[model samples]
Target: MESCLPILLHSLCFVSLVLQISYASDSISAGQNITDGQTIVSAGGNFQLGFFSPGNSKNRYVGIWYKISAGTVVWIANQENPLNDSSGVLKLTPQGVLTLLNHTDGIVWFSNVSRSTQNPLAQLLDSVNFVVREANDNDLDDAIWQSFDHPCNSLLAGMKFGIDRAKGLDRYLTSWKSVDDPSPGDFTYKLDSSGYPQLILRNGSVVQFRSGPWNGLRFSGFPQLKPNPVYSFGFVFNQNEIYYYFNILNSSVRQMLVLNDNGISQRLTWVDRTHDWRLYASGPTDECDTYALCGGNGNCNMASSPKCVCLTGFVPKYPSDWESMDWLNGCVRRMELNCQGGDKFLKFTNVKLPDTRLSWFNKSMNLQECKQTCLRNCSCTAYSNLDISGRGSGCLLWFGELMDIRQFDENGQDIYVRMAASEVGKILAFSRQSHSEDLELPLFDIITIVNATNNFSDNNKLGEGGFGAVYKGVLENGQEIAVKRLSENSRQGPVEFKNEVVYIAKLQHRNLVKILGCCIEQDEKMLIYEFLPNRSLDCLIFNQEEGVSLDWPKRFTIINGVASGLLYLHRDSRLRIIHRDLKAENILLDMEMNAKISDFGLARSFGGNESEGSTKRVVGTFGYMSPEYAINGLYSVKSDVFSFGVLVLEIVSGKRNRGFTHPDNRLSLLGHAWTLSRDQKFMELVDPSIASTLNPLEVLRSIHVALLCVQNDPHDRPEMLSVVMMLNGESTLPHPKQPGFFSEDSVSEASSSSGGKHQKIRPTR
Candidate 1:
């Protein structure tokens, strides 16, 4: 052999040795072998297919990964079958089949294909898909097979994750047995198509989590699936196929959704800076995400303390078990159903619709027709709009007891559950109203509420306001709640209730208080909210002892938090809202002392291009009202900025705007703050309680921004965005002009900015 190599250096054997030793990072022709030391990269150099040993494992396997991030495997070809040594060879046959051979030339793994072709060639494309097709043909449809069709744990962009019903071919993700071992694990994330198609994560035969049924927008339980800059996603269910796919929008970004060895499905994105993967999102995030955590006929809420409760018409089947927090026993109907004649359907809103495996859906039926169909069929337990898109059409009906029910504060589909006729009348006031359909909030029963608050005991009362008396309550399941009972003598009535429901039900943010449910029965109108342990800002700032508890850092946090909440209401919310009554009294503090804005009863929403609205009657707290809103009866997003400015000054000084008096002058808090700002003595306005713990610059900046927000001219007042920027120290401050309502002039006798008094609150013009 040595004599032949020197004499005939350009022989076929020499050529074969060159192919084996040198790297050929592209397509591999038939009869060629990519041995252990050799690898092939995609045409665009984004992906590379080669032999890899993950982690501490000695055994090697064939896989694909991003060339930009080494060792980050996305797809493993022989995950379940690893080679014992480096003698492994990956070969493509003329039959268009790809085979992995061991040292003995025995096949370790081979691609399964129904057909074969001549001149077959395997090439790695930039999309990360390794395909085997005829060398002359490039179309994917005509190819024999592809690695994407048999995914191992990784679901890359532009790959389908469902079943091709026509061909009975299913594509899914499976977890690795261990980090060091690439063999298949116990968990698999796949699309189940028993009735409607929903994503499910399972541990062998046991179901761990379900992604709820797909409404046109997103999976019901998956709120993290929102619009993002990285990718666009969709689910398709046609006669031939049913699958979910995501296409990356930014070509420079690399991402994949994978089922990890721990059975958690996570979406990971490659970050160039870190040179590693970032966890974009993951499923089964909380206890509510547990499959049927509350069992059948029960509701689970994350914000609520105990997190589970029976549906309106149901009660715990085992009282002792429920008291012990063993909710697996579930709930049962309080009254017997009198078949179709004596039963009525009660609508449950903002909820993860129950398990769809025991469900049936029709594409042609409208919502009204869907309700009627459920009524006629005695076995039908519930029904909802199958597709919640456009005006919403199609029907999905659930039979037997409902399971896996959960409640969300916003963006959830509605379902109508059957109940006894007697139980339905108690909530008829809400269901019969035309506006009720848009209030995407749950409904609480009078019986449960009455028991929780001990029939509105004054001892349990939290506070009283123009709205109503608020009583704190604890449900049978140990969930804490705050109930606001409307007074019979109060002028605030239905309009205020509707405004609060419509606005807060659809609005979601960390800085906003969450409404749990509402009660309209037994001659009562009430709203239920999550119980915040720290209560309102007024409760603390007005009290000398409690005020000391709020140090400089906490006060600054509250000020910044209120500004962000107001910014969300004015600009970032689903609809543009003008809060006419944003004051320190309406700012609530949670257990962590983080602030959340509350009381949306006087909030007004404007549609697109309609920035401002005018009203004949004006109503708001006197000290917090802006000049334009108080006098001209015109309100805009700037009006809320004015109130926020007042709040900021009050928080810093530990003084209330109304009934505030300076020892040397008749100036209110606003006038005092403006004087301090004008003199460059803003540090004098800092609350004495926080004097020892203050940052002089932050305090000065807060005072400066507050003056700008309270400027007399609406145009002079910065928008909430600018207010936020100034508060965050992101933008330089603009000197503020004269603030509104600074003098001691009588508001009753209108002179400049103050107008004639309004007869009532929120009287729609």
Candidate 2:
């Protein structure tokens, strides 16, 4: 009996070894399964293919799960079509395809990867991806096909999530139908690479949210995206494909990109000590993260309560509807597109960039060549750099309306918008004509603005602009000047040059910027202007420490000084011009807080008896444009009046109108002050930095006049002359009405424009 027992044990051990060998061998065929419930773990133990019921469900489904974690399913072979009984078999065909057959039903699930080879084997690699290849091909790169190309809700480390242009097959991740069901759901995550690579989360055809375009470092839309030691991101762009993939930098950290049931994506990693996954980051943090919340050609600032706004060239389509918080309609262009030979391009800087779906690209063209190409093609509406790396080369042009534009403090791309050449000429003539008025600096003997900027050092940078950057310099003469050097391959061009010269030369005022001279030689167009020691008004008004130093006396002096400056333009200047773009940043401060308006890139001119005029092309910033000017392309001194009102409120509060959060109401500073002044609580609206040190009567008077100037109806709003007179107690101010975009409730009205293709919101340039 003992001898018989030894023989039985030896036979059992040999049987176990044989089964292990069969499992690892490539000859095991599919029809030879023996059990009711079974699983085949890959030879490398990286993945397991089997049939299992999810949660407590009675129905069974064939799936691929992690071998290390049996419950962690990565791919399901039959998610939507589940078998009622456990009679399923997963088999690889000779044609390099995977097929799941059922005993009860003839066909269950199948993977169809077309291959010419007759002898094929299915294997799971260490990356947990299932692949099928020719049995004779030792080179894994020659895989006949792979399941990783078609992902479910999970994005593995090396998987490509983009379109196969040749096959028109777009590989995207669809969310699980439910928490318990692994079936596909309405939500899908697709890599939109039409213009750039941006991860868009969509519910059916509608976009639920978006991850801004992938900048050189990270996604531009997500400011929180920073360097993480756990993973590294890579973007692949070529003629055939555009894909975004990530690799685990730390082998010890197991991380996954998962689209959960509620549509939140979390990049989670396992923590050994905690014995659980730690959340690294999540998307859709704020309202602005939603796809095109504000509308086309709009900018969004999350710091502000009502985060959506139009860019400089657009206005609300339905102003009343937008004021009601229905932003789906988006905004309309204040300036009409004539598309004539007179059309020009306006450059917007430091922006996240609009959607590039209807755009064309060229890799070798410079900015000048790109502009010429776009100008020749009337269909081209805008143009920008295809790649913003290494001094920025390549060109991308947009046809039709520019949509979904947003400003980012970091990793912003430049876009040149189409406008009337006459309009552009008006802007160019200002700078160009003024430039020649002064003695021209010698061509070849010019000092690079960078050298003047101390080798273009960041520490020496005076300020930045749409054209390029400004640096304070003292050219050997010990005479200080602000050098405006054009960025390499910048959007601003000769037209902008001519505009600056023509417009600024004819105008003369103590409160206006004076052009000393210019250097236009060898790809460089540098504007040399009289350097103001105190710098821009934004440097003082928005700085906490600097703002505290601006006492009531100083604030009053600045208010009066700015008023006089506007008065000179509206009533005193020979041209009777309208500074379409009037904002805190454009107001230059001298040694004594005296204000000087600068940057006429967007300003428009008017002749005698020109109280009002219409333009097909509207150009100005948001939060300052009057309803008529922003919506109907109508402009006059009244437009400047609205801007002045906004400027006054901003200076007094030391906060930008774009991100201003109303405490008791969801209204802009102009609107909130109007409400408060109407209720005699205007003093509460003063900036805390200057509140304690301001004159109550003067501040109240200024606030009242500002409100009167920002009235919803352009006619109801006081002109710059009346506003200045009221500020100086020379005229009695009238009661103000509800300002455009003012909100009475805590729920502010969303901007009328959406971040979609058609509607765009113009910003206060």
Candidate 3:
């Protein structure tokens, strides 16, 4: 029995050895060497370490790649020292170092470890990190050396891309020379740890692109990089290190960010269905994304025809070059800033805060303090909030010219640029001007308005709103004007009145109501606008007797015109404005039945990438208000888009959204439109008066765009610019989720008010 037991134990031991050899590990102990073709895989089989060539190249190199993917190398051990033959050998030395050796027994490359140990091992981790550490040491921070410190072209999950302040070790991704070559390329993507931490891409030493500073959530310039199903990303800036990293939400979802050979940085993800990598996102997406594309003191807007334009209060240094579209020389101030008390800052909104290469910051300063600080500094050219989180804290002041400024339709930061007080005064005066060749606005006297309207007589009354009454007035020069007089008992105060004046005075578009001038005297606030004979849009669209006059063509024109006006306010205009009170009653019709957007009293201007805002005061018609704005007091350009969507449905059906009740379902107009559209019965939602004159395809498209605009999620709602494109059939529209406030009960509760007047509620802060 004892002899049989020895034989059995010997056989069992041999079998165990064979199994171990078959499923070989991804780790090597001290003094062990792995020759070419011998590979090591991670314990979890997520990553593999081996010697290989990169894309159609014969030169061999030691690298690590995903075990599930072929040739998708994430790290290269000896990228600069590539072997000409397949004689490369990776070895873990007894001194706790990893070295790449040639067939000639010469060291080709080696890991530089600060300390040495007798017991050493090299292991490939599931995080795709290759490290050489003491055999018993499991802590990463105590490792002798790691591949994460020397990345190639790719940034893998759990890898830090930034700087180790104490060690002065810069960890960054460098592009490959070419698809076939693994040598370092001209372009490098790294974190600029100076001032506020930001990502910067450089072609050699020249900056190519800069990801604006981290703003708690993301890099201000990269608003699209939000937390998603694929991964969770974050930035850490501290005394020890400053780095950006991402973690995969699901282990199965393999992802990587690679700075490609052509200098384009792309986030790619593996898709099992396609058996290929899908591009999740890419940057330097437009012409404006080019670093310093608009140069210093200039702003770049991709939506504009001329991509580059000088900043306000500045002019091209070389006018001829600017005219020829060469903005390399940037711009110079039109008027020199006199530092004393004569310099004022011009606030710019919805913009990518300027490059912070030469900047200063204070983590605890408020906006008011920031302004005072900038005012005190003679070299300060611009100032903004250092961190835009919560009520906004910290201060950032820029010296000299602001560079790499880009305008965004949404998600931006605000910057106040120092300007000559005279320039500031000129702008203020221009905003108040009644009529001048240099300005478009006109300032009218209260006496002139009183005389034009016959001293506020009822005969000249056009309509009454939440703000006040609109009166038809005839100027002494025989020009007809509509005067919007603020009621003493109205909820809208001087702030709203001045807000309207400031916004309407600067905006000029065919579809936007023209502001002739304004009158502010002895507690009387009046806005003078060009008179429209046809009155408001609701009078024509909601009244059954007058609705028939608006044929399909006229309604379509009105819709198109309103969209154009909205597009202007949201993108093309000098200032990004949100028409909070976008409704049928606020839309005025001209003599030719052209729709003109009026009443900017509830409007808000977004500055420096300011996409949305929250306020205690929610002002807008209930039926037209987006769910976010109505329920949460959160307003954005999308809020106006939602209102526009409701208006479109109302325009097409000739029904008042406020009192709308579906015949079969107890739904509001928006709910009814969404139901019909969802069921593919769009024609049923059309108004009987214009049904015969409607183009089926056009109406369907318009309905689709409207549905997109009224989507339950604000992000699901298309931007006004996108709305315009969809209306003109210039772009494809996505299927909408449920419409906001689609339920009958919710709609009823929201629209319980009388008179169809704009609702002004002050939410408890």
Candidate 4:
């Protein structure tokens, strides 16, 4: 018996060596097989394919789990029909089919196969996809079958969670029945293709939660998926497929989206420190995420005491139901559509667009065109930009009722909803009404402003302007504010004030000034803004001592910010707004010197193809005025372009365009710039204060762009969009023509006066 024991030990040692051989081989041929004690690891040894039992369960299943983190299963093969003993075998056939067998060698689970490969092999990729393909052809597209097409509870990096329309294959995530059971559970997270591709989570056939449609940047409702250091993600909608996928940006972090047994969808990342998984983020985080919680035409806000409220121009469909906390009926319009081309759209800012099941989209349409198209169709209930990316593009219009609308604190979207003319009138008349606090806009009272500003003390005063004096104020809650006191002498009446309010409130861009609320009481009207600590652009560029700090990069940033703001106004916004008062003082600067275009009292909105308007009363500053606008009373988007050119020149030279005088030449700033550009000495035009930090190429390009902008002919001037491209591009530019207001050494009052109902405003500090 002792002699036979040594022979038995040698046999057991040989068996253990055979099992260890399986761990290093990433791929296997048709003749190869893996038993319960053996396993196959990925090429990089990141993942392993083997047989395993789930938490406290005796039943075993063939699954894929992280090789680095033991017992953390990701994908399962025989989840529904598990083996009771350790007799499971996973093998590939000559037909390129992957099969799992029981002790009797009867196949319990098998992968789907379309066609047999010439050299059949089953390989586990580092991307976590188990594929059956030709050994000579490693291209993923040529694979006959892959485990990625059938994802289970865990969605690893590079996994597509969407559909392959032509092939009729839907790739999605299904929760496990329980921690101990690997069967498909009641919850599924998948893309719904009814209208747009929005992620929807369901408990059987009933929706449990929803991720709003993709808006170019991120999911409109999934703000949690923002710029992060760990991963980069995006949604793809092409002719062949539509899907959402994320890649681990940092290879050190192993992350996966898991739909747990509890029906909760969360992003999990493996933490090496704790040797366990940590929750990165979760969806349907609050009540507002519940699908259609407030039903159609209702806007949900978790910050509000009662989470749901009817949209403007709408009322609770059933008031009693709303009172009883049963708001499923949603809202109904107080006034029906006056569809004789009388219905108008009321813009709702900072909102999550409603369900899009009954919607149509145009990828090439502008916001103005979208508004007109919605008006043309009486059935259209609302419209918004489909792609809210750079400068914004595409349009999405919803028909019938808008459902599942919610409000976001930041990065929210703006949607235009159809409304009766009378309802629109009420909104226009809101400025004259008493103080009211609303979701879209808020109103501050006279007493609050007085208290905030310490009764208009000189110490709190920021600066005085044509509009009025600017005062720095701090609210009781420690929020700093900038209050613009509209002078009684200032020509901006309630109507103009209301227009400014409506425009600024609806406008949401990084380059535009953000208005908090307003004060309209005791015959006083004031515009409240988020205080900018760095004051105005004029302070930075025109002050000799302060101007030295602004290097070429900082100056270029200001130029780009202003250009982006003007571009948004002219082309991206719902209305084409002409910022008639574009001047140095009107440009506010944050602590980082980021420029924001403000003072919209003199701004005009042009609808449809109306590019220019002639006003008998000219407004805006003298030196910044364009030739056509200052002389012929013609103001367009080009006028703003001309002003931007003047601003760029001022920033470069550290001089004011209105009073600039060169030692060598008695030329105006425009004339001096033109002379420099023609002589190929544009770099000489840069500010002496920034001589040490100037980029000659950038300085030359800026001067050339300025010359292009201040051209005498409005026809010769490039549009703001083109100006942006020219500044940011290295393409050959067209030679600039003579400037309109750059005549000789002297300035003319008549030409300056020719540029308003009330002329020239000095913006507040």
Name the regions of candidate 4 deviating beyond 4 angstroms: 1-22, 425-765
Could you estimate the TM-score for every candidate? 0.88, 0.53, 0.66, 0.60
Clashing pairs in 1: none
Worst 10 residues of 2 by lDDT: 1-10
Query: Which regions of candidate 1 are displaced past 4 Å?
Result: 1-22, 424-447, 466-468, 493-524, 551-577, 678-681, 691-705, 721-729, 744-765
* Preferred candidate (lDDT higher): 2 or 4: 4
Off by over 4 Å in 2: 1-37, 40-46, 67-70, 94-96, 116-118, 166-169, 192-199, 210-227, 337-344, 420-765
Model 4 alpha-carbon miss at residue 572, Å: 16
Q: Candidate 1: minimum summed lDDT over ten consecutive residues — where?
A: 1-10
Q: List per-prediction Cα lDDT, in the order shown.
A: 0.80, 0.65, 0.78, 0.79
Best prediction by TM-score: 1
Q: After superposition, how far is residue 253 of candidate 3 from its true place, in Å?
A: 2.1
Each prediction's total of clashing residue pairs, residues at least 3 apart in sequence or on different chains, is 0, 52, 15, 4
Q: Per-residue lDDT tens digits of candidate 3, residues 607-669?
A: 677788998666677888898877778899999999999989888888877777776778888
Candidate 4: residue 350 lDDT (0-100): 74
* Candidate 2 per-residue lDDT over residues 418-489, each given as its tens digit: 765432322222223233222112121254445656876777687665567787775432335687777775
Q: Assess the local accuracy of residue 441 in candidate 1 as a C-alpha lDDT between 0 and 100.
A: 43
